[model samples]
Target: MKRTWIKKSLLVILLVGILFVLAGTVYLKMNTYAPSEAALAVAKTGKSEDQILFFEGEQGKPAIIFYQGALVEKESYSLWAQEVAKAGYPVYLVATPLNLPVLQQNAAEAIIAEHQLTAVVMGGHSLGGVMSSRFVSSHLDHAIKGVFFLASYPDEKGSLENFSGSVLSITGDRDGVLNQEAYQEAQRFLPDQTVYEVIAGGNHAGFGSYGEQKGDQSATITNEEQQTQISQLLIRWLENLE
Candidate 1:
């Protein structure tokens, strides 16, 4: 009888665990930020396969693998990706499970291998950037050419202090959603030569087209203006990469 009771208890725990996981998954899916109509319109021009949105560019340039911000739809970055692709660098906007890059931080490896990409740059906005940094740090042998962050910073575990690759960090001057203290602290983890820039009238939500984020400050500049500057900065940086 005791053995049977123990078995029943185990079954009950297993059932509870499964229920908890299901509930969490549903919650995450429901809370996701969908792309706006403008973003959706731009995304239609790109080709999507599986979870990746591919923006084709020049044949022999470094490819970009970008992850999406937490709970933000991958399509939200479509407009920016299209602009970058026009500059001759193919861009792959990757969608993460539950819209959280942290859940699949090493996703770029598959993309790199699938396309046989040699020179590659990995970047993202907000939480996506943090995970991309973690991936770069963990896969140093991948020979990533550069890393870029939008309103984000790497965590201690994803530090690139000794990395030789190029690093660029762009943040908005009026970003209320970004943790200033943490961002300042994370700077020590970046390489000495990292290039940092700030958009004069930008805010946290200006990095993507997912509408105004809960904690972000109002941007003086339009989203289109912010994105244009970002793409220009990114293209110039990419062109100058060694």
Candidate 2:
């Protein structure tokens, strides 16, 4: 009877653990920020396969591999990626597991190998940026020509202080969700030539068209205006990289 009771207790514990895991997975899936109709319309121009959306551009130009922000749908960045592709670089918008880039930090490697891309620029929004930076830091041999961050900063472990590539960091002046303290502290991790830009009245959510993010301040500028500014900056930066 004692052995039977112990076995039953173990079974109950296993069942509870499985339930906890399922609940967490369901919560993450439900809490994800879905792309707006406008974003979806723009995304239609790109071709998607499995977890990657490809925006074609001119031949011989370095490709851009972008990672989406945590809990934000990958399609939320379609408009921005489309604009970049128009400027002459192919864009691969990668969808991470559970909308979390941290789960696949080395995703760019397979893309580089598959496309036979000799040169590449990697970037991401928010937490996606941090993970991208981590990948770039560790894979310096992958021909990464530059790194960009949208309302994001690299963690100390992903420091690029010694990187010889171009770096661009963009954020909104009214971004309430960004950790100002951490942003300032992370500056030492970026290279000396890093170009920093701030949109005057823009907020955190201006970087993507996924509606207002939780805990983010409202933006004074329209999403269109902010995205246009960001697109222009990205184009100019990519041009300079060549």
Alpha-carbon RMSD to native, per candidate: 1.3, 1.0
User: What lDDT tens digits, residue by residue, belong to model 1 across residues 179-222?
Assistant: 99999999999999899999999998888888898888999999
Candidate 1 residue 26 C-alpha distance from true site, Å: 1.5
Across 61-136, the per-residue lDDT of candidate 2 in tens digits comes to 9899999999999899988889999999999999989999999999999999988999899999999999999999
* Model number with the top lDDT: 2
Superposed on all Cα atoms, model 1 deviates from the true structure by an RMSD in Å of 1.3
Clashing pairs in 1: none
Backbone clashes in model 2, listed as residue pairs: none
Question: Model 2, residue 177: what's the lDDT?
Answer: 91
